[model samples]
Target: MTRSTTDEAAVPPLPSPKERRRLREAKSLSEKEVAAAVGVTRATVRSWETGRASPRGRKRALYAKLIAPEPAVKPPAVKPSVVKPPAVTPEAGAAAVPEAAAAAVPEAPDLPVAPPVPEAPPAAPPADPPPAPAPAPNSDTRSGAEAPDERRVSPAEAFDELYARTAPGLVRQTYLLTGRRALARESVERAFELAWQRWPEVAVDRDPAGWVRAAAYEYAMSPWHRLRRTHRQPDAPPTEPGKRALFDALLDLPPAYRRTLLLYDGVGLDLPETAAETEASTPAAAGRLMTARAAVAERLPELADAAPAEQSALLHDRIGGLARAEHVPVPRPARAVRTGSENKARLWTRAAVAGVALLIAVTGLTLHTAPTHYEQPISPPERVGGVPPRGGPQKLTAQDLKLQKSLSEQLAHGPERLVPQLE
Candidate 1:
């Protein structure tokens, strides 16, 4: 026998997705069991449980029965009670006697006493109609229906989401830090680049936005900015005098104090949080915050009248306004950042390798050219201690030369005499 459409329509409604899951878990049953009982795929059961899809027709009835089964024990029948109008005497009626007074009247002995009416049994409740699903505690009205399933997103997608969500605000904030639109954009972009490079750590961070913000703040507030010619001159001040004064005051304060003030006031961080981010003690952060506030108050005549708390609030608004007023460039796309990070990593790797190779070559050259053995150095010649200074054929040379000349003259004249003597 086939079931009629009416029978299908009479099937009880399914509970909410969360309720379905809860029911299955309460019974110590898994999705597989529900799927097997309902003759559907485990995935379908999961979708039903997650509220991604609702079962229909036969599947719906089967699922409702399996997950939200009727209680085995029937509730005890209850007798119905009816309240009758209090009987009143004509005299009481004319006097507008109260119901309590009429009910209090005792019946006369001669009057026939009416018997109490027996209560009728209540009609049987619809056979095993599952109890109406109780509303989920602390759940929103919309939660009565299945909530949209939360899908697992890839890391790149998650990174892109974080970047898109925070990049614009970060740009504005960095603008506040540096006061230069170009630098602000650059700082935010560079921060994202760094985040992409370390996405594993960044993605797992409790506050990814804070991580990027800190990086951007550090870049924007770097002292090395002073060396950049573009950063030497201040950006065009805000057109409004209030904003201009606020901006100047911020720039005038030291970077640490300005950052502390910004985090505590502008970003709404608590003192301890500000200190943690700034790497300072809470008292130090508080001191910087106070000092910064005082400096700003000194610069702005308007702020001078306000109390410290009011001054901080005013500064926050003004800083926010100042940041928003500047037109910072849109943040670079996550893909672009990831690509840039990869390129940068590759470049650094090559550079490190080249540096190592160059160092090795230099060491090898030094070893090749270095002297192998030690050599003694020659000493300059010196005169003998006992030897008299040699007088070259000097004055004595004149006498000797004269004697030789005389002898030579005698030999030239007496050559024939010497020959004869020799003969």
Candidate 2:
């Protein structure tokens, strides 16, 4: 009996749903039959074949079995004899094949497709709104207003004004204090230099001139100035015959008495002002002034030879000459009193002025002559049982009183006496 051959070429497996549908149609199996064989519902089988779903699990296994290849059947054993065909030439065999069949099949024409338009990226969400602008500064705000610069005057301008107003008086005062024209100039100049440096703070002072005067006095009294004055003493010795005599008498006074006398009398400062300037108490200043006055009294005999008008003229001349030598301008005289029917008023005014002038003159004279009183030898009172005499009535004979009065007058008018002695 002839054996049937089951080794047909295996068909290529379907790759997609469309190929699977074609394969199912070729199989001629109804959707219901395929579903029953694959152990799935008809709808499932239809979906699988229609590409809506894919077979899985038992259904996939069953479908795979249904399409599985049949096993090859063995043929009856045949004798090994074979017949050989004649060899064919390459050209003759190639020519026997149809030209259309030998030529390569053209690939299906590529379908033209428009390039996909790229949708612009969705507009970025708008950025957070910018932070609100800062509020404008108010005109009233402290930071908004311009700061004022502190006003100040130049030192030169200030110094010029000060010098113009004060230089003459200060130089004159300094000459009187030092009794040396050059030294006086130096003192006033130095005081002005110091004032220049402190003008901003000092210009507003109630008495700027007075401040300068005090400063000049302080400078004149300094130890350095004292040393300088001592070094310059020879050069400063009074040259004028009259002044030389006065200076000689003044040199006889003790240093303390001379200083007090000069400051209180020559400088013409009040007792309290003199004390304050000299760093002394009022009582001490008074004592010094009195001592200077007494010293002048003791020297009065020689001084009295000069006439009173001569004495006044000499003093005025010496002071004025010293001031000029020191480069100090003299002050202008005060306005003269007017003469009118108001004679009584003028008389009273004159009297008051005269009284004030007299008081000043007396104070100056007392201070000048105080040194003489201090230097007078005090005779020891007759002791009672060795106890010193208590404060008894000061013994004063007529002659002694007369001598004292004469001495006072001489001291008051003497050209030779520039300073008084201290007791």
Number of the top-ranking candidate, with TM-score as the measure: 1
Predicted structure 2, TM vs. truth: 0.33
Tens-place lDDT digits, model 1, residues 117-210: 2232232333454587988854665644645664558888988899888889888877777778888888888988899888887876657888
TM-scores for every predicted model: 0.56, 0.33
- In candidate 1, stretches whose alpha carbon ends up further than 4 angstroms from where it belongs are 1-151, 365-423
lDDT of 2 by residue, 1-423 (tens): 223222221222333443344345446555677777878798776566545787665556577666444467989876643222234444332323333432322233563322222332222333465697776654433464554753456755665666777777776666555565566666666666666656665666545776677677667655565566443562455566655545555556665565566666565556655554454545788898676655654554543455544543444455445445444434321111111213545677899999999999999999887875446689989746867757868889999999989897774654665797899
* 10 residues in a row with least lDDT, candidate 2: 332-341
Query: What are the Cα lDDT values of the candidates?
Result: 0.77, 0.57
Report the Cα lDDT for residue 102, model 2.
24
